[model samples]
Target: MCLLNLIVRLSYVDHTQDVSHTGRVVELKNYVRGLLLDSSGPLTKVELINHLQRLGVGYLFEEEIRTVLDAIWKGKDIEIENDLHATALRFRILRQNGYDASIDYFNSFIDEMGSFKACLCEDTKGLLSLYEASYLAFPGETRMDEAKAFAKRHLKDRKGKIDTRFEEQVDHAFELPIHYRMLRLEARWYIDMCEKDETMDPVILELAKLDYNILQASYQKDVQNGSFPTMYYRWWRQLGLVEKLPFIRDRWLECYLFSLSITYEPQYGYGREVLNKVNQMITLLDDTYDVYGTVEELELFTDAIDRWDTSAIKQLPEYMRTSFLALLNFGNDLGYDTLKDQGWDVIPCVGKLDEIARGDVPKSIQCYMHEANVSEAIAREHIRGIIDETWKEMNKEYVTDHVFPRAFADAAVGLAQRAECVYVNGDGFGRNQSNSEINGQVMSLVVEPIPINNV
Candidate 1:
């Protein structure tokens, strides 16, 4: 019986491998796509789109989704009833997909007293939808700010009193808003939750499970097949930095997952490798500046990096010398690869900046606080503003095609997005499991594999 079990497991693996290589995935894709379009009402359609996005399979039906959204946009001028859930779902989805969805529709939800109607809290689902939609607010949307605060206060108050079904959802929303979640990780979480629902289509659930497992198997194989882990392990060993700087994080896996989040398609293997190496270097540099290196040593390192000269490493302590050289060599090699492959001199972009904080031993935020003579809270607000602007700049580069070879530009934006997502709560990658939000992300994406259904 034991032998039979082993044989069955092996056969299952082979079957999944065969299925991944066949037309079944394509068929499943269409099967799911049809369900998305088959929804009867606009509310149902928008909800389906929302589910597809959260499930991370929306990419497979991008064109169809766009058509539906475009139609919705054309009908935007039409006044739909102010049913909170439907209105908020339509508003969030529309704005998220680049439609000019006005928050004016929410005016109906407000009472004559200039507050959201008190009675609306009874519909927890509608309140939850409104809470989620509030996050899509742009600058100067005072209404959204009020809505968010109102929704949150009510949700927290009702946390214990609410039904068990709504309790988990409310807690999750409070912990991490959907706007900030990584797509694939959210999909994994949502798929598990969705599969148990009797209302969910079994076919869609099965396909989602199978597709996720297949990709996970591919990712597992990637780890075994590639030199990434080996190269990172050697670099960490050779640098001896982890032992030397115990305060710094030793998270090579998280760095690689950051790369995976940037571009998960197997075809972008080279891009992923490049990103992983780059992220590894950035991680080391962040730690060196934030924890290990003395201000003076950091100043020297900063100067050396700016000059892009190896001889400057002579001024560094013995502990710092090898890392400087390793960073320099990595940059040179990357430049060479980019030049040879894309005919682009990437060295200029790669060497454009180095971190040099003044008036603080550790954080750049401290420098801001010192310079501006503000409290930590004010300084953090300033930092958030800077991040928002940076995102705008990144988006501009993508839209205007300011960067050559769109793939690199997209990867650059993706890296920026991933960094913001991970660090939004705190320095998530500073220490593994330090932040539950990112820890959940790491576990979902890297450590855990999806359990296949109907295998």
Candidate 2:
């Protein structure tokens, strides 16, 4: 980390005494709920709900949010032609929460010249909202592509005309759309922005900051004393992954940030530990396929994993043995815990990791292109289809009950979701140390706590 980044991060010091605002949290949730319920119109309600989500408080009132969105779904009273802000906000939030919102509604915003209406640029806030919403577009949504281009071009053109705060926000959003950002990190950013907005409720501002600080306190405690730093550090050194491979990422901090993003609640410390270790192992296997191993060696590794025998280690190359052994030990420990706690052995789940490994053994698109006897585009599509189907299973696990504890299950699904987010453009993790995005995440969520108000 640079000195400036280090200084900025360290500024968020831990408070000497822990802070808890249980009563105020209840009051704040009630206040937000009442506001959601009492909005004067559909547009107002949608806007309020969007604020709740962007502020990261919507999780506290899921049913209330669903109720309002349901009413809007039934009424369908939004005037896309007249009010672009409400229409875009409604479209984004509804689709994000799984409503059938379509980008086709933005047809009215385009002119005969096939560009967004020139006059619409004057509605800068609305344009920014539209830009944010365009990110939620699905495949084949050409109108959304146009909207993203139009909004981004105009937002950049008007940068100097906007206030510094708004300029800063526009730049940040342009770099990363909120749809792609983790919710808690967005909350940390928005809380500062909300402090400057005179219209925001002071109580909501206070509570959001407090909740953020308290959570940061818990995560920071883990940073200092958690098993992750001490144990993983020793293990990684012992495994000799860095010196041996020299290509894989040494990103324990970034991996833990991923764990926190999945389930940041304080009580899920064990879940974080488990997820972090799983992430490390996944990184090991991913590198072996994508970078280190040749086709024949990867075949051997995959076969050994499939056999699920202690003797399998002998079949692996000398460099692959320790990594494979570490993975097996993790499975053994995890399976034993599952048996003791849930009364079921997860050795089957452990065993199935080989099946997953086999799927990735092919590695590159070249393998798919040759094996499937399809064009490159078609081969890519097949992989995408697999990802989409996997999401359905992950989503099923997310909402329905399963053998794993709820928190661990959530973390498991979150790992999948975040992998999609990070790797959507490409195999970023494969690039390892040069990826600044994961490094920034480590700085924001794990290395730094949100600075709290002294009063």
- Output the worst ten-in-a-row residue range by lDDT, candidate 1: 1-10
Residue 377 lDDT in candidate 1: 94
Which regions in candidate 1 have their CA more than 4 angstroms from the true location? 1-22, 76-80, 231-248, 356-427, 432-443
Clash count per candidate: 0, 0
lDDT of 1 by residue, 1-455 (tens): 12123224333343346455346678878877787677466766787788777777776788999988877777643334458888888987876665657778888889999999998877777888888887767656778878888888777777778777568778778766675555576678788778766787676666666666666655545445534444555655676767875666667666766887778765666776777777667767766776788879988888888888878988888777877887788889889988998899988666642452222354768889999999999999998767655543443344352438755664565566576666766766665534566556655664456655353
Q: Model 1, 424: alpha-carbon shift in Å? A: 7.0
Q: Pick the candidate with the highest lDDT.
A: 2
Query: In order, what is each prediction's RMSD in angstroms?
Result: 5.6, 5.7
lDDT per prediction? Answer: 0.69, 0.72
lDDT for 3 in candidate 2 is 26
